[model samples]
Target: MVKPATAADGRWDADPLLGLVAGCYVAAAVAPPVVFAGDAGLSLAAGGLYGLLLGTVLAVTAVVWVAVARARSLVVRLGRSRARWLLAVAPVGYALGGFALLGQTGIAGVLAFFAGLGAALLGIALAAMAHTRYVAATVDEASVEWDGRTGWPERARRRWRRGAWVVIGVTAVGFAVGVLTDRWWLRVAAQALFAGGVGFAQTGQERRYVCTEAGVEQRLPVARRLFGWATFDGYTRTDEAFVLHRPWRTDLRFAVADIDDPEVLADVLRRHLD
Candidate 1:
Protein backbone atom coordinates (compact mmCIF):
# COMPACT_ATOMS: atom_id res chain seq x y z
CA MET A 1 0.00 0.00 0.00
CA VAL A 2 1.23 3.48 -0.75
CA LYS A 3 1.53 5.50 2.43
CA PRO A 4 0.39 9.07 2.62
CA ALA A 5 3.05 11.68 3.24
CA THR A 6 2.65 13.34 6.62
CA ALA A 7 2.91 17.04 7.18
CA ALA A 8 4.22 18.41 10.46
CA ASP A 9 0.60 18.89 11.38
CA GLY A 10 0.15 15.09 11.15
CA ARG A 11 -2.69 15.18 8.65
CA TRP A 12 -2.79 12.80 5.70
CA ASP A 13 -2.02 14.40 2.39
CA ALA A 14 -5.12 14.50 0.18
CA ASP A 15 -3.58 12.28 -2.47
CA PRO A 16 -2.04 9.11 -1.09
CA LEU A 17 -1.06 7.64 -4.43
CA LEU A 18 0.64 10.45 -6.30
CA GLY A 19 3.94 8.62 -6.46
CA LEU A 20 2.28 5.64 -8.10
CA VAL A 21 0.60 7.93 -10.57
CA ALA A 22 3.92 9.58 -11.43
CA GLY A 23 5.79 6.33 -11.36
CA CYS A 24 3.63 5.04 -14.18
CA TYR A 25 5.34 7.41 -16.58
CA VAL A 26 8.71 7.23 -14.85
CA ALA A 27 8.66 3.46 -15.10
CA ALA A 28 7.98 3.73 -18.80
CA ALA A 29 11.02 5.93 -19.26
CA VAL A 30 13.49 3.90 -17.18
CA ALA A 31 12.30 0.35 -17.81
CA PRO A 32 14.49 0.12 -20.89
CA PRO A 33 17.64 0.94 -19.01
CA VAL A 34 16.68 -1.22 -16.06
CA VAL A 35 16.24 -4.30 -18.19
CA PHE A 36 18.64 -3.82 -21.06
CA ALA A 37 21.55 -1.82 -19.77
CA GLY A 38 23.88 -3.95 -21.87
CA ASP A 39 24.54 -3.82 -25.64
CA ALA A 40 21.91 -6.53 -26.18
CA GLY A 41 18.95 -4.18 -25.66
CA LEU A 42 16.58 -5.09 -28.52
CA SER A 43 14.19 -7.42 -26.73
CA LEU A 44 11.30 -5.68 -28.45
CA ALA A 45 12.16 -3.08 -25.79
CA ALA A 46 9.89 -5.63 -24.18
CA GLY A 47 11.10 -4.80 -20.71
CA GLY A 48 10.57 -1.07 -21.14
CA LEU A 49 7.10 -1.28 -22.69
CA TYR A 50 5.79 -3.99 -20.41
CA GLY A 51 6.91 -2.11 -17.34
CA LEU A 52 5.18 0.99 -18.64
CA LEU A 53 1.98 -0.90 -19.26
CA LEU A 54 2.09 -2.43 -15.81
CA GLY A 55 2.57 0.93 -14.12
CA THR A 56 -0.28 2.36 -16.16
CA VAL A 57 -2.53 -0.49 -15.16
CA LEU A 58 -1.64 -0.15 -11.50
CA ALA A 59 -2.13 3.58 -11.50
CA VAL A 60 -5.46 3.40 -13.26
CA THR A 61 -6.65 0.64 -11.00
CA ALA A 62 -5.72 2.58 -7.90
CA VAL A 63 -7.47 5.71 -9.11
CA VAL A 64 -10.59 3.84 -10.04
CA TRP A 65 -10.75 2.06 -6.73
CA VAL A 66 -10.38 5.29 -4.79
CA ALA A 67 -12.96 7.07 -6.90
CA VAL A 68 -15.44 4.26 -6.45
CA ALA A 69 -14.94 4.14 -2.73
CA ARG A 70 -15.70 7.82 -2.48
CA ALA A 71 -18.36 7.96 -5.19
CA ARG A 72 -21.24 8.38 -2.77
CA SER A 73 -19.78 11.51 -1.19
CA LEU A 74 -18.21 13.05 -4.31
CA VAL A 75 -21.09 15.22 -5.49
CA VAL A 76 -22.09 16.54 -2.10
CA ARG A 77 -18.51 17.12 -1.00
CA LEU A 78 -17.31 18.60 -4.22
CA GLY A 79 -20.54 20.61 -4.68
CA ARG A 80 -21.31 22.40 -7.98
CA SER A 81 -17.69 22.13 -8.99
CA ARG A 82 -18.22 18.41 -9.54
CA ALA A 83 -19.29 18.93 -13.10
CA ARG A 84 -16.29 21.06 -13.87
CA TRP A 85 -14.03 18.43 -12.37
CA LEU A 86 -15.78 15.68 -14.30
CA LEU A 87 -14.97 17.44 -17.51
CA ALA A 88 -11.35 16.66 -16.77
CA VAL A 89 -12.19 13.12 -17.83
CA ALA A 90 -11.92 14.30 -21.44
CA PRO A 91 -8.17 14.72 -21.16
CA VAL A 92 -7.81 11.36 -19.45
CA GLY A 93 -9.77 9.79 -22.28
CA TYR A 94 -7.47 11.45 -24.77
CA ALA A 95 -4.45 10.17 -22.86
CA LEU A 96 -5.72 6.59 -23.07
CA GLY A 97 -6.45 6.87 -26.78
CA GLY A 98 -3.14 8.54 -27.46
CA PHE A 99 -1.15 5.78 -25.76
CA ALA A 100 -3.12 3.06 -27.52
CA LEU A 101 -2.39 4.66 -30.85
CA LEU A 102 1.33 4.81 -30.10
CA GLY A 103 1.56 1.04 -30.35
CA GLN A 104 0.65 1.11 -34.02
CA THR A 105 3.28 0.34 -36.68
CA GLY A 106 4.54 2.53 -39.56
CA ILE A 107 4.33 6.30 -39.99
CA ALA A 108 1.03 6.63 -38.14
CA GLY A 109 2.57 5.42 -34.90
CA VAL A 110 5.54 7.73 -35.25
CA LEU A 111 3.34 10.75 -35.88
CA ALA A 112 0.97 9.94 -33.05
CA PHE A 113 3.69 9.53 -30.45
CA PHE A 114 5.85 12.49 -31.39
CA ALA A 115 2.88 14.75 -32.05
CA GLY A 116 1.41 13.91 -28.68
CA LEU A 117 4.76 14.60 -27.05
CA GLY A 118 5.08 17.98 -28.76
CA ALA A 119 1.48 18.92 -28.09
CA ALA A 120 1.80 18.46 -24.31
CA LEU A 121 4.81 20.78 -24.16
CA LEU A 122 3.15 23.28 -26.48
CA GLY A 123 0.00 23.21 -24.39
CA ILE A 124 1.91 24.15 -21.22
CA ALA A 125 3.67 27.08 -22.91
CA LEU A 126 0.39 28.33 -24.37
CA ALA A 127 -1.42 28.01 -21.05
CA ALA A 128 1.24 30.01 -19.22
CA MET A 129 1.17 32.71 -21.86
CA ALA A 130 -2.59 32.89 -21.39
CA HIS A 131 -2.29 33.97 -17.71
CA THR A 132 -0.38 37.17 -18.45
CA ARG A 133 -2.18 37.71 -21.74
CA TYR A 134 -5.70 37.37 -20.41
CA VAL A 135 -5.42 37.88 -16.68
CA ALA A 136 -4.37 41.21 -15.19
CA ALA A 137 -1.28 39.92 -13.46
CA THR A 138 0.83 41.70 -10.85
CA VAL A 139 3.26 40.61 -8.22
CA ASP A 140 4.38 41.25 -4.67
CA GLU A 141 7.13 38.72 -5.15
CA ALA A 142 9.66 41.45 -5.23
CA SER A 143 8.18 43.07 -2.13
CA VAL A 144 11.54 42.95 -0.39
CA GLU A 145 13.93 45.53 -1.79
CA TRP A 146 16.14 42.61 -2.72
CA ASP A 147 13.60 40.57 -4.61
CA GLY A 148 12.71 39.94 -8.30
CA ARG A 149 14.92 40.28 -11.32
CA THR A 150 17.04 42.97 -9.79
CA GLY A 151 18.33 40.96 -6.82
CA TRP A 152 17.97 37.38 -7.98
CA PRO A 153 18.29 38.14 -11.65
CA GLU A 154 21.54 36.30 -12.03
CA ARG A 155 20.36 33.27 -10.07
CA ALA A 156 17.14 32.79 -12.06
CA ARG A 157 19.00 33.51 -15.28
CA ARG A 158 21.57 30.86 -14.53
CA ARG A 159 18.82 28.36 -13.72
CA TRP A 160 17.07 29.06 -17.00
CA ARG A 161 20.28 28.59 -18.92
CA ARG A 162 20.99 25.33 -17.14
CA GLY A 163 17.53 24.02 -17.89
CA ALA A 164 17.97 24.82 -21.58
CA TRP A 165 21.34 23.14 -21.69
CA VAL A 166 19.98 19.93 -20.12
CA VAL A 167 17.21 19.62 -22.67
CA ILE A 168 19.58 20.28 -25.55
CA GLY A 169 22.03 17.69 -24.29
CA VAL A 170 19.31 15.08 -23.77
CA THR A 171 17.91 15.69 -27.23
CA ALA A 172 21.34 15.32 -28.80
CA VAL A 173 21.98 12.08 -26.96
CA GLY A 174 18.54 10.75 -27.94
CA PHE A 175 19.28 11.47 -31.60
CA ALA A 176 22.56 9.62 -31.47
CA VAL A 177 20.98 6.63 -29.69
CA GLY A 178 18.13 6.52 -32.18
CA VAL A 179 20.56 6.32 -35.10
CA LEU A 180 22.82 3.66 -33.60
CA THR A 181 20.12 1.37 -32.22
CA ASP A 182 18.76 -1.46 -34.39
CA ARG A 183 15.34 -1.36 -32.74
CA TRP A 184 12.83 1.24 -33.89
CA TRP A 185 11.12 1.05 -30.51
CA LEU A 186 14.41 2.06 -28.94
CA ARG A 187 14.39 5.22 -31.03
CA VAL A 188 10.86 6.04 -29.99
CA ALA A 189 11.62 5.41 -26.34
CA ALA A 190 14.73 7.57 -26.48
CA GLN A 191 12.82 10.46 -28.03
CA ALA A 192 9.91 10.16 -25.63
CA LEU A 193 12.17 10.11 -22.59
CA PHE A 194 14.19 13.03 -23.87
CA ALA A 195 11.00 14.94 -24.57
CA GLY A 196 9.92 14.44 -20.97
CA GLY A 197 13.31 15.74 -19.85
CA VAL A 198 12.65 18.88 -21.90
CA GLY A 199 9.37 19.36 -20.10
CA PHE A 200 11.07 18.95 -16.73
CA ALA A 201 13.66 21.58 -17.63
CA GLN A 202 11.01 23.95 -18.89
CA THR A 203 9.18 23.63 -15.60
CA GLY A 204 12.34 24.41 -13.64
CA GLN A 205 12.50 27.92 -15.11
CA GLU A 206 11.35 30.30 -12.36
CA ARG A 207 7.75 31.27 -12.91
CA ARG A 208 6.59 34.81 -12.18
CA TYR A 209 5.40 34.28 -8.63
CA VAL A 210 3.53 36.70 -6.41
CA CYS A 211 2.56 36.52 -2.78
CA THR A 212 -0.89 37.89 -2.06
CA GLU A 213 -3.21 38.16 0.92
CA ALA A 214 -5.04 35.05 -0.21
CA GLY A 215 -2.01 33.00 -1.18
CA VAL A 216 0.56 32.61 -3.94
CA GLU A 217 0.11 32.92 -7.68
CA GLN A 218 2.60 31.30 -10.00
CA ARG A 219 2.78 32.67 -13.51
CA LEU A 220 5.02 30.24 -15.28
CA PRO A 221 6.01 30.60 -18.91
CA VAL A 222 4.15 27.36 -19.60
CA ALA A 223 1.38 27.53 -16.99
CA ARG A 224 -0.30 29.53 -14.23
CA ARG A 225 -1.37 28.30 -10.81
CA LEU A 226 -2.82 29.75 -7.65
CA PHE A 227 -2.22 28.14 -4.31
CA GLY A 228 -4.07 29.23 -1.24
CA TRP A 229 -2.42 29.06 2.15
CA ALA A 230 -4.75 26.22 3.06
CA THR A 231 -3.21 24.23 0.25
CA PHE A 232 -0.04 23.88 2.27
CA ASP A 233 0.05 22.44 5.77
CA GLY A 234 3.64 23.29 6.68
CA TYR A 235 7.14 24.03 5.55
CA THR A 236 10.17 21.80 5.42
CA ARG A 237 13.78 22.51 4.57
CA THR A 238 16.09 20.07 2.88
CA ASP A 239 19.61 20.43 1.66
CA GLU A 240 18.41 21.32 -1.82
CA ALA A 241 15.08 23.08 -1.34
CA PHE A 242 12.70 24.94 0.88
CA VAL A 243 9.38 23.13 0.51
CA LEU A 244 5.78 24.11 0.99
CA HIS A 245 4.13 20.90 1.97
CA ARG A 246 0.84 20.65 0.17
CA PRO A 247 -2.23 18.57 1.01
CA TRP A 248 -1.16 16.41 -1.85
CA ARG A 249 1.77 14.03 -1.50
CA THR A 250 4.11 16.36 -3.31
CA ASP A 251 5.45 19.65 -2.01
CA LEU A 252 6.06 22.85 -3.92
CA ARG A 253 9.66 23.93 -3.48
CA PHE A 254 12.25 26.52 -4.37
CA ALA A 255 15.98 26.49 -4.20
CA VAL A 256 17.50 28.56 -1.38
CA ALA A 257 19.59 30.62 -3.73
CA ASP A 258 17.13 30.90 -6.61
CA ILE A 259 14.86 33.48 -5.03
CA ASP A 260 16.09 36.86 -3.87
CA ASP A 261 15.98 37.84 -0.17
CA PRO A 262 15.71 34.33 1.17
CA GLU A 263 15.13 35.39 4.77
CA VAL A 264 12.38 37.84 3.80
CA LEU A 265 10.68 35.28 1.58
CA ALA A 266 10.69 32.71 4.35
CA ASP A 267 9.15 35.19 6.76
CA VAL A 268 6.45 36.10 4.27
CA LEU A 269 5.70 32.49 3.52
CA ARG A 270 5.34 31.63 7.21
CA ARG A 271 3.15 34.63 7.85
CA HIS A 272 0.77 33.78 5.00
CA LEU A 273 0.07 30.22 6.07
CA ASP A 274 -2.89 29.51 8.35
Candidate 2:
Protein backbone atom coordinates (compact mmCIF):
# COMPACT_ATOMS: atom_id res chain seq x y z
CA MET A 1 0.00 0.00 0.00
CA VAL A 2 1.23 3.49 -0.75
CA LYS A 3 1.62 5.69 2.31
CA PRO A 4 0.91 9.40 2.82
CA ALA A 5 3.74 11.77 3.20
CA THR A 6 3.90 13.58 6.53
CA ALA A 7 3.71 17.33 6.76
CA ALA A 8 7.36 17.45 7.69
CA ASP A 9 8.32 15.43 4.65
CA GLY A 10 6.32 17.69 2.30
CA ARG A 11 6.76 17.55 -1.47
CA TRP A 12 10.33 16.37 -1.45
CA ASP A 13 9.22 12.87 -0.56
CA ALA A 14 7.20 12.58 -3.74
CA ASP A 15 10.06 13.58 -6.02
CA PRO A 16 11.24 10.05 -6.55
CA LEU A 17 7.82 8.98 -7.79
CA LEU A 18 7.84 11.92 -10.16
CA GLY A 19 11.21 10.83 -11.43
CA LEU A 20 9.95 7.30 -11.92
CA VAL A 21 6.92 8.57 -13.81
CA ALA A 22 9.14 10.73 -15.98
CA GLY A 23 11.34 7.74 -16.75
CA CYS A 24 8.31 5.62 -17.67
CA TYR A 25 6.90 8.36 -19.86
CA VAL A 26 10.20 8.55 -21.61
CA ALA A 27 10.16 4.79 -22.16
CA ALA A 28 6.56 4.80 -23.36
CA ALA A 29 7.34 7.68 -25.65
CA VAL A 30 10.19 5.79 -27.32
CA ALA A 31 9.33 2.06 -27.36
CA PRO A 32 6.58 1.47 -29.96
CA PRO A 33 8.53 2.28 -33.09
CA VAL A 34 11.24 0.02 -31.80
CA VAL A 35 8.87 -2.94 -31.63
CA PHE A 36 6.98 -2.12 -34.82
CA ALA A 37 10.24 -1.97 -36.76
CA GLY A 38 10.31 -5.73 -36.84
CA ASP A 39 7.01 -5.77 -38.77
CA ALA A 40 5.69 -3.44 -41.47
CA GLY A 41 1.92 -3.42 -40.96
CA LEU A 42 0.24 -1.42 -38.17
CA SER A 43 -3.21 -1.76 -36.61
CA LEU A 44 -5.12 -0.60 -33.52
CA ALA A 45 -4.59 -3.99 -32.01
CA ALA A 46 -0.87 -3.74 -32.65
CA GLY A 47 -0.72 -0.28 -31.08
CA GLY A 48 -2.70 -1.40 -28.06
CA LEU A 49 -0.40 -4.33 -27.65
CA TYR A 50 2.65 -2.11 -27.83
CA GLY A 51 1.09 0.40 -25.48
CA LEU A 52 0.35 -2.27 -22.93
CA LEU A 53 3.89 -3.53 -23.15
CA LEU A 54 5.42 -0.07 -22.91
CA GLY A 55 3.16 1.04 -20.06
CA THR A 56 3.88 -2.08 -18.07
CA VAL A 57 7.57 -1.52 -18.51
CA LEU A 58 7.25 2.06 -17.31
CA ALA A 59 5.15 1.14 -14.27
CA VAL A 60 7.46 -1.69 -13.32
CA THR A 61 10.55 0.43 -13.73
CA ALA A 62 9.01 3.18 -11.62
CA VAL A 63 8.16 0.77 -8.87
CA VAL A 64 11.65 -0.65 -8.87
CA TRP A 65 13.30 2.75 -8.81
CA VAL A 66 11.08 3.88 -5.98
CA ALA A 67 11.93 0.76 -4.07
CA VAL A 68 15.62 1.38 -4.60
CA ALA A 69 15.24 4.97 -3.44
CA ARG A 70 13.42 3.80 -0.34
CA ALA A 71 16.12 1.22 0.34
CA ARG A 72 18.78 3.88 0.09
CA SER A 73 16.79 6.16 2.40
CA LEU A 74 16.58 8.74 -0.31
CA VAL A 75 12.82 9.00 0.07
CA VAL A 76 10.41 8.14 2.81
CA ARG A 77 7.24 6.36 1.78
CA LEU A 78 4.06 8.25 2.55
CA GLY A 79 1.37 6.22 4.15
CA ARG A 80 -1.00 7.58 1.51
CA SER A 81 0.19 6.83 -1.97
CA ARG A 82 -0.99 9.08 -4.79
CA ALA A 83 0.69 7.02 -7.48
CA ARG A 84 -1.04 3.66 -7.01
CA TRP A 85 -3.71 4.38 -9.60
CA LEU A 86 -1.16 5.96 -11.86
CA LEU A 87 0.53 2.59 -12.11
CA ALA A 88 -2.66 0.97 -13.32
CA VAL A 89 -3.67 3.84 -15.63
CA ALA A 90 -0.32 4.59 -17.21
CA PRO A 91 -0.23 1.52 -19.49
CA VAL A 92 -2.95 3.04 -21.64
CA GLY A 93 -1.03 6.27 -22.09
CA TYR A 94 0.85 4.84 -25.06
CA ALA A 95 -2.40 3.82 -26.75
CA LEU A 96 -3.30 7.50 -26.98
CA GLY A 97 -1.89 7.13 -30.53
CA GLY A 98 1.42 5.45 -31.04
CA PHE A 99 -0.12 2.87 -33.29
CA ALA A 100 -2.71 5.31 -34.64
CA LEU A 101 -0.04 6.88 -36.79
CA LEU A 102 0.07 3.62 -38.74
CA GLY A 103 -3.36 4.40 -40.18
CA GLN A 104 -2.02 7.46 -41.96
CA THR A 105 0.51 5.34 -43.80
CA GLY A 106 -1.97 2.72 -45.13
CA ILE A 107 -0.94 -0.07 -42.77
CA ALA A 108 2.21 -1.01 -44.72
CA GLY A 109 3.67 2.45 -45.02
CA VAL A 110 2.24 3.15 -41.60
CA LEU A 111 4.39 0.35 -40.39
CA ALA A 112 7.50 1.87 -41.96
CA PHE A 113 6.80 5.42 -40.82
CA PHE A 114 5.89 4.27 -37.37
CA ALA A 115 9.14 2.39 -37.30
CA GLY A 116 11.00 5.59 -38.16
CA LEU A 117 9.02 7.66 -35.66
CA GLY A 118 9.57 5.18 -32.87
CA ALA A 119 13.28 5.10 -33.59
CA ALA A 120 13.41 8.86 -33.46
CA LEU A 121 11.38 8.95 -30.27
CA LEU A 122 13.73 6.45 -28.68
CA GLY A 123 16.68 8.72 -29.32
CA ILE A 124 14.76 11.67 -27.91
CA ALA A 125 13.75 9.71 -24.81
CA LEU A 126 17.33 8.75 -24.11
CA ALA A 127 18.40 12.31 -24.49
CA ALA A 128 15.71 13.37 -22.05
CA MET A 129 16.93 10.90 -19.48
CA ALA A 130 20.52 12.09 -19.83
CA HIS A 131 19.38 15.69 -19.46
CA THR A 132 17.34 14.89 -16.37
CA ARG A 133 20.29 13.21 -14.73
CA TYR A 134 22.46 16.23 -15.38
CA VAL A 135 19.87 18.63 -13.95
CA ALA A 136 19.21 16.47 -10.90
CA ALA A 137 22.89 16.24 -10.11
CA THR A 138 23.38 19.97 -10.38
CA VAL A 139 20.40 20.80 -8.20
CA ASP A 140 21.15 18.28 -5.48
CA GLU A 141 24.84 19.10 -5.17
CA ALA A 142 24.66 22.94 -5.05
CA SER A 143 28.12 22.79 -6.49
CA VAL A 144 27.81 25.40 -9.20
CA GLU A 145 30.30 28.21 -8.63
CA TRP A 146 31.52 31.34 -10.33
CA ASP A 147 35.24 31.00 -9.63
CA GLY A 148 35.84 34.31 -11.47
CA ARG A 149 38.65 33.12 -13.67
CA THR A 150 38.84 31.93 -17.27
CA GLY A 151 36.82 28.83 -16.38
CA TRP A 152 33.47 30.36 -17.32
CA PRO A 153 34.92 31.57 -20.59
CA GLU A 154 36.40 28.17 -21.42
CA ARG A 155 33.25 26.30 -20.49
CA ALA A 156 31.08 28.68 -22.46
CA ARG A 157 33.37 28.27 -25.44
CA ARG A 158 33.10 24.51 -25.19
CA ARG A 159 29.34 24.64 -24.87
CA TRP A 160 29.04 26.79 -27.97
CA ARG A 161 31.42 24.53 -29.90
CA ARG A 162 29.52 21.44 -28.84
CA GLY A 163 26.22 22.96 -29.92
CA ALA A 164 27.71 23.94 -33.27
CA TRP A 165 29.07 20.46 -33.84
CA VAL A 166 25.71 18.90 -33.14
CA VAL A 167 23.87 21.21 -35.52
CA ILE A 168 26.46 20.74 -38.26
CA GLY A 169 26.75 16.99 -37.90
CA VAL A 170 23.01 16.46 -38.00
CA THR A 171 22.63 18.72 -41.02
CA ALA A 172 25.54 17.11 -42.85
CA VAL A 173 24.24 13.59 -42.25
CA GLY A 174 20.78 14.55 -43.43
CA PHE A 175 22.21 16.14 -46.56
CA ALA A 176 24.26 13.07 -47.37
CA VAL A 177 21.30 10.79 -46.82
CA GLY A 178 19.15 12.98 -49.06
CA VAL A 179 21.75 12.94 -51.79
CA LEU A 180 22.30 9.19 -51.67
CA THR A 181 18.63 8.20 -51.56
CA ASP A 182 17.32 10.97 -53.80
CA ARG A 183 14.32 11.02 -51.49
CA TRP A 184 13.87 14.57 -50.31
CA TRP A 185 10.94 13.70 -48.09
CA LEU A 186 12.73 10.91 -46.24
CA ARG A 187 15.87 12.97 -45.83
CA VAL A 188 13.93 16.00 -44.70
CA ALA A 189 11.94 14.10 -42.10
CA ALA A 190 14.99 12.33 -40.75
CA GLN A 191 16.99 15.52 -40.52
CA ALA A 192 14.11 17.39 -38.98
CA LEU A 193 13.85 14.95 -36.11
CA PHE A 194 17.60 14.37 -35.71
CA ALA A 195 18.72 17.95 -36.00
CA GLY A 196 15.88 19.19 -33.85
CA GLY A 197 16.88 16.82 -31.07
CA VAL A 198 20.46 18.08 -31.24
CA GLY A 199 19.28 21.65 -31.05
CA PHE A 200 17.05 20.98 -28.06
CA ALA A 201 19.74 19.11 -26.12
CA GLN A 202 22.35 21.79 -26.73
CA THR A 203 19.91 24.51 -25.76
CA GLY A 204 19.02 22.76 -22.53
CA GLN A 205 22.68 22.40 -21.61
CA GLU A 206 23.34 26.06 -22.21
CA ARG A 207 20.44 27.12 -20.01
CA ARG A 208 21.86 25.71 -16.80
CA TYR A 209 25.51 26.51 -16.21
CA VAL A 210 27.96 28.25 -13.90
CA CYS A 211 30.97 30.31 -14.73
CA THR A 212 33.95 28.66 -13.17
CA GLU A 213 37.17 30.46 -12.20
CA ALA A 214 38.04 30.43 -15.90
CA GLY A 215 37.23 33.57 -17.85
CA VAL A 216 33.89 33.77 -19.58
CA GLU A 217 34.49 32.87 -23.22
CA GLN A 218 31.79 31.08 -25.26
CA ARG A 219 30.65 31.60 -28.81
CA LEU A 220 26.99 31.22 -29.69
CA PRO A 221 25.27 31.12 -33.07
CA VAL A 222 22.64 33.75 -33.45
CA ALA A 223 20.72 34.83 -36.59
CA ARG A 224 24.07 34.40 -38.31
CA ARG A 225 27.26 32.65 -37.09
CA LEU A 226 27.90 35.36 -34.48
CA PHE A 227 29.49 34.37 -31.18
CA GLY A 228 29.58 36.29 -27.86
CA TRP A 229 30.25 36.03 -24.13
CA ALA A 230 27.80 35.95 -21.22
CA THR A 231 28.52 39.58 -20.46
CA PHE A 232 28.12 40.65 -16.86
CA ASP A 233 26.64 44.07 -16.10
CA GLY A 234 27.13 44.16 -12.36
CA TYR A 235 25.53 42.98 -9.08
CA THR A 236 22.80 44.16 -6.75
CA ARG A 237 23.04 44.16 -2.97
CA THR A 238 20.34 41.48 -2.71
CA ASP A 239 22.79 38.96 -4.13
CA GLU A 240 21.24 39.25 -7.56
CA ALA A 241 23.59 39.64 -10.50
CA PHE A 242 23.04 41.58 -13.72
CA VAL A 243 24.41 40.73 -17.10
CA LEU A 244 23.91 42.87 -20.17
CA HIS A 245 22.94 39.82 -22.19
CA ARG A 246 21.59 36.42 -21.35
CA PRO A 247 24.12 33.66 -21.82
CA TRP A 248 23.17 30.51 -23.67
CA ARG A 249 20.30 32.41 -25.31
CA THR A 250 18.17 31.89 -22.24
CA ASP A 251 16.05 34.42 -20.39
CA LEU A 252 16.56 34.07 -16.68
CA ARG A 253 16.62 36.13 -13.52
CA PHE A 254 20.07 37.01 -12.30
CA ALA A 255 22.06 34.26 -10.57
CA VAL A 256 22.15 35.14 -6.90
CA ALA A 257 25.56 35.01 -5.27
CA ASP A 258 27.31 36.53 -2.25
CA ILE A 259 30.86 35.84 -3.20
CA ASP A 260 33.76 37.20 -1.20
CA ASP A 261 35.29 38.90 -4.25
CA PRO A 262 32.54 40.84 -6.06
CA GLU A 263 34.82 43.75 -6.88
CA VAL A 264 37.42 41.61 -8.61
CA LEU A 265 34.71 39.82 -10.58
CA ALA A 266 33.21 43.14 -11.61
CA ASP A 267 36.59 44.39 -12.79
CA VAL A 268 37.16 41.24 -14.80
CA LEU A 269 33.82 41.65 -16.48
CA ARG A 270 34.62 45.29 -17.24
CA ARG A 271 37.97 44.31 -18.70
CA HIS A 272 36.27 41.86 -21.05
CA LEU A 273 33.99 44.64 -22.24
CA ASP A 274 36.98 46.81 -23.01
TM-score of each: 0.40, 0.32
Tens digits of per-residue lDDT for model 2, 57-129: 6665565555434442232221112332343344443443544555643443443344345434543443333
Residue lDDT tens for model 1, 149-234:
21123455467658767876877777787788766665666776777666655544455566665466665554445565777888
The most accurate candidate by lDDT is 1
Winning model by TM-score: 1
Candidate 1 off by > 4 Å? 1-122, 125-175, 201-207, 221-223, 237-242, 247-251, 254-264
With a 3 Å backbone cut-off (N, CA, C), the pairs that clash in candidate 1 are: none
What's the lDDT for all of these models?
Answer: 0.48, 0.43
- Candidate 2 achieves a global lDDT of 0.43
Once model 2 is optimally superposed onto the true structure by TM-score, how far is the C-alpha of residue 102 displaced, in angstroms?
Answer: 12
How many clashes (backbone atoms < 3 Å, residues ≥3 apart in a chain or on different chains) does model 1 have? Answer: 0
Question: Which 10 consecutive residues of model 1 have the lowest summed lDDT?
Answer: 1-10
